[model samples]
Target: MDEIVVGIDVGTTKVCTLVGRVEEDNSIRIIGVGIEPSEGIKKGAIVDLGAAAQAIANSVERAEHTSGVEITSALVSLASANVASVNSRGKVGVSGGIVDDYDVIRALEDARTIAIPGDRELIHVIQRGFVVDGQDGVRAPIGMHGYRLEVEAHIITALAASVENLRQSVASAGVEVAQFVLNPLASAEVVLTETDRQMGCVVCDIGGGTTDLAIYVDGDVWHTMVLAVGGNHVTTDIAHGLRLPIAQAEEIKKQYGHAIRAEVGLEEYFTIRPFGEDEPVQINRQELAHIIEARVEEIFSLTLQEIKRSGYDGLLPAGMILTGGTSALPGIRKLASKVMGMPVRTAKPENLVGLVDRLDSPAYSTSVGLLHWALSMSAQDLAPPRRRRMKGESNMNLDAIKNFFKRLLP
Candidate 1:
């Protein structure tokens, strides 16, 4: 029997679920996928528990039907603006003169001991690098002989209340929260390459209610930030500027919004039928383009300032990789490049062995990445030499594990 894993992405605009099985060859075969319109979420934070739970339940039900499996737990992706990150360092003496898994874990724990605010909980303690004695840049010092060990890591923190609310919502949907992954971190796992990270890159996920930014350098996540602005704000802008209803503005933005003014012709025109108005109003493509360009440019400009504030602008030689629903907007990459003064390209999630057609879009990257995160967590939990069989294993247990695997087999 194989191991099954599930991933759930709870976003401001939607909830998505994905299920997959880990094959013998260590590849993931996706077997189920689902999405539902989101509610009770504002700026990536849960405002109404009941509404969020309902949305999650809807998405999970759809996935269960498609995959024919009862999912009880999942690795969830979180995109709240309440998340934050800081750098910390730790060092310890290698008593046995040998570095091992225990040493590594201890070093990480030591790094995590730094004082954080009472309201914050550590989300991730990513090991940047290890220094064995005086030698630096040791990716894995395990099994090496050294008298001292030092570790540099980034400690990501988030508001405990916000995280607890998310967990509660998932629990209300009848699913256990196996893990809570930071949204940008999960997106990076799928969209970023080793080369890109080594060369220095920024991953910008323009979500429905928040824009998540993660900057990587030398294959390490150096900085992360979430802006309380995203594609939804663009929609609101269109709604206000054109005097149209929010729904109509959103539709128009999806159908006609272009981030670069040059992409739209002055002669081209589109009609927006405002709600409560008897007649449809005609608007030039250039006019709509101008509105979109202004907002998108503002977003890019702010992103650039964030990079500068993070002190990672000069480090990003590979430029930026834009993902998320908003990245799908026409001409966004061009506008980002022009404003950031660096090369920019749209990114899609990677490393899936099945369901390529269903998981190819930027809108689903974070959800798909959540699946990858689950697999990674499972792998870490079952690291080599730790697999033990229970003495009284029963048929029921076997059936449960098998059923779980069957649901994930593509």
Candidate 2:
């Protein structure tokens, strides 16, 4: 029996369904991956339930065919302009002058007891770090002698209506949504290394309708935000500026778009089918680059503003790690580095094996991260290790795998 886990990434531009089998070393082996152009969704929110459901069904069917397994449920990525975040604290007294797992659980429970609005639902309550007896920056308290325990946590919230609509659409497709994982956290799980997190870094995922940002310091998430600007906005600018249709504009952007205008020679040109013109119109490639540059700069500028607002702006020395669909643009690294005044690099999911080579690209980062996040959380829910298991120990337990999924949901 294989421990199979599925991840569904519903984005503004496409819907991706991936089926992964847990291997002997607890790594993911890609068995099947399906993708199709997204419709009936906008800016990560469901606009038409029927259309969204059909897209989900088709993607899941394609993946199932390749994996030779029927997927009844999946872990979905949660993203939208409505996501919000806040930090809170909780404290509890230790029993027997020692902090135990139960005491840590109680402290966490108390930490999450903030007065969230009824209209908004809590998505995740992640601990930043814990303190024992007023001692700050305590990473682990279990088995430690302490009279008091305190926890500082970061809470993420989302609009109930938006999340419910997304869940309904997935349900309509006949697949249950096991949980709604935050998009930034998912993308960061695979892209950022532990050293990067410790040195402070920002994971920026440039999707079609949103640019998700997650900041980490000392190996804990300190800030997160989702901006309502992305690749689609740049495409729209090209379409309107060149009088080309949206499809053609998108094609031109991917085929010829550049982030820096100064580097592109003015003599280089690309042809496009302009509206009301029989023959194609020749446009200066430099001009196209200029148009893209403006929008890209604005996006980065807004991102910088958000960093400033976070007040942890100066903490990240490791700088930015860019991923997602839009980060594939040529010279994007240079543009981001120039605008952000920090080191910039592009990344995709690197912790993959088996039939997943095709998924080794920026566009598939979020999708891969979703499955990785689920597997990690599932591992955390297991019993603690007592020495090492025998060499013949079996890792394939379907009941335990099913229980893993059950533990993931709220």
Instruction: State TM-scores per candidate.
Output: 0.91, 0.93
Clashing pairs in 1: none
What candidate 1 gets wrong by more than 4 Å, as runs, is 350-357, 382-410
In order, what lDDT does every prediction score?
A: 0.83, 0.85
After superposition on all C-alphas, the RMSD of every candidate to the true structure, in Å, is: 6.2, 4.8
Question: Model 1: per-residue lDDT, tens digit, 335-367?
Answer: 999999999989887656776677778988888
- Cα lDDT of model 2 by residue, 1-410, tens digit: 98888999999898899999988889898898888788798888888888988898888888899999898889898889899998889899986687655576677778778998999878877778889998999876766899999988888889999899889888887789877888888899789999999999999999999999999999888888889899999999999999989999999999999999999987999888899999988999999999999999999999999999999989989999999889999889999999999999999988588677678789888899988877876665544232323444545343453333223233
- Model 2: residues with Cα > 4 Å off, grouped in runs: 382-410
Model 2, residue pairs in steric clash: none
